[model samples]
Target: MAQLQTAVSMIYPPRCTTCGDLVESDFGLCGPCWRETAFLGGAICDACGVPLTSGGKDGVFHCDTCMQDPPPWVQGRAAVIYRGNGRKLVLALKHGDRQELARPAGVWMANMVRNLVSKDTLVVPVPLHWSRLLRRRYNQSALLGAEVAKNLGVSFCPDALLRRVRTPSLEGLSHEARMVALEKAITPHPKRGHRLDGKPILLVDDVMTSGATLKACTNACFDAGSGPVRILTLARAVKEA
Candidate 1:
């Protein structure tokens, strides 16, 4: 097996996940692309994981938007801020059919929320409507969530939540509009909902923009009797100042 693996690597050297540049490792970014990626650090919003300009002496801090409209989930963390190479990674995994990216992306997300995972934590992903799932052939969120669960050594419930309604793309919608469109669109899966009972949940997603979809998923987890729920995303979309 070791000899076969070496032959494969020799035939096809590993390339950067984002830019297709030759890299020394598999499922990783090259140095230049890695430098350009906006990995999150410092103080971030407790509700949504957006990096804040100030750390706030109190040790706890939230961005103005999260303070005004709190997220449905208890806490949130993201591996990267949505921009530059970070955005490229998200778009590639989500739309460019780069399913293998989930491995590294999930590892990043798991590291971000490592402190939140418990022995009984269950990893769940935002669900896609049947039509969308059929069209896309796979749910990006589920791929990331499963990988996170594997890295964390926790149970993964990919279908714990189900998208009941087929909603339109919310790309250009306002926050309120997105919420309305997603209203009751997600529900706990009838057969799998039992897995969430009293379990701390680690909700995973590819990206968070308005967070309306995550809000719906969190509500479904609570409705299914899940314990404290936290969210993790590959990237957090932040507005420019």
Candidate 2:
């Protein structure tokens, strides 16, 4: 299949996800777009994975935001800093029906958190409300989580988390309101036999903004017997300093 994809790419070169420029590989951005994407690296929050300007003491760093109010998950990692092109690629995947970008996004996500994955790990995705799922015709996180699990050779449970409640859109809500709205929105899949059973879980998502949604999802996983939940998103929104 990879060979076939290569052949197809040779015939019809794959274009960038954010821009139409021809890139060397599939589901990627051109050099300029790549540069424009602020890939997160270097020192970051030990809990939430926000890049830090100054190196921390004793090799343990927690951003001020996380220090004040930590996330429910054990740790987190994001592939790109959500701003210009990162935002574009994420929007393309979320609302533009560019499902093809999931492969590369998953690849980047897998690479970002390969150390967190193991044979016993359970890869799950943040659930979408049925209404939104029906309207979107796909769950981008499920696509990303499946590909990530395949790349890491771990168990992928697309329905591990279920969005039982369909709430209003989270956009434009205050942080506190967003937190309240996301409460009880996501819960573990009620399938009787499938339990996390102390297994580590990698929660996948397309993007993380205030992380309220991911927090709700993480709490659900913990309540379902999942252990040491870690997060990985394609992009994370950060305001300018």
Candidate 3:
């Protein structure tokens, strides 16, 4: 058995999923690729997780956008920005064959939202429409949420929320337009709403581009009686002005 295992390992050696560098484990980036990924840190927004780099002292700070127009979710956290190596990793997971990255990405998200996770909390993924799911094979958000939920020792409710309506792609759309497109697009599953009631829902997603999608999902959770919906994402794009 040992000899056969060694032969198989030699036949299919693990490589870094991002840059294809030789690494000790699969689904990782080489040192340079890993360093290039911008892992967000510092005094972040209490609402949106935008880093507050202005001259204010180190403490809880909300970005100007979030301050002016807070999102529906109680708070938000992200592992990185949607640029550079961060974007590469995200694309690899979503488009490229890097489903293996979900483990590390989910672990990072779990640590970032550690403060908000509780015993009664439920990790809920923003759903993909049936058509999208069929094409993508699996929802990246659901994969990440399930991984994080395992680490948190809480329930992972992949179907707690459903994307009942399918709309055109939201890329390059204005914030208002995106919101309009997602109007009533997400809803808590009729039978699953009871499971969500009174539970602190940690909404998970792959990215927050403009935040309209997350906002819509948050409304669904709240409308179904979930308590204090907080958000976690692998990456986030600062809402366009």
- Each prediction's whole-model lDDT (CA): 0.90, 0.86, 0.85
Tens digit of lDDT per residue, candidate 2, span 1-241? 9899888988999788777888886777888888888998888887777788785889767889888898888889998988898888888889999998899888888988887667898889898888889999999999999989988889888887888889788888988999898888888888821566587989999988888898998888888877888999999888788
Off by over 4 Å in 3: 1-11, 55-58, 239-241
Collision pairs in model 1:
none
lDDT of 1: 0.90
**What would the per-residue lDDT of candidate 1 be over residues 32-120, giving only the tens digit for each residue?**
99899999988888878999878565777888887888887889999998999889888988899999999999899989887777978
Ranking by lDDT: 1, 2, 3
- So what's the TM-score on candidate 1? 0.96
What C-alpha RMSD separates each model from the true structure? 1.2, 2.0, 2.3
RMSD of 1: 1.2
> How many times do residue backbones clash in model 2?
0
Model 3: per-residue Cα lDDT over 106-221, one tens digit each:
88889898877788899999999999999989999999999999888889899998899988999999999999999999998887767788889999999987888999989998
**How would you order the candidates by TM-score, starting with the best?**
1, 2, 3
Candidates 1 and 3, the one with greater lDDT = 1
In TM-score terms, candidate 2 sits at 0.93
Deviation (Å) of 25 in candidate 3:
2.7
Clashing pairs in 2: none
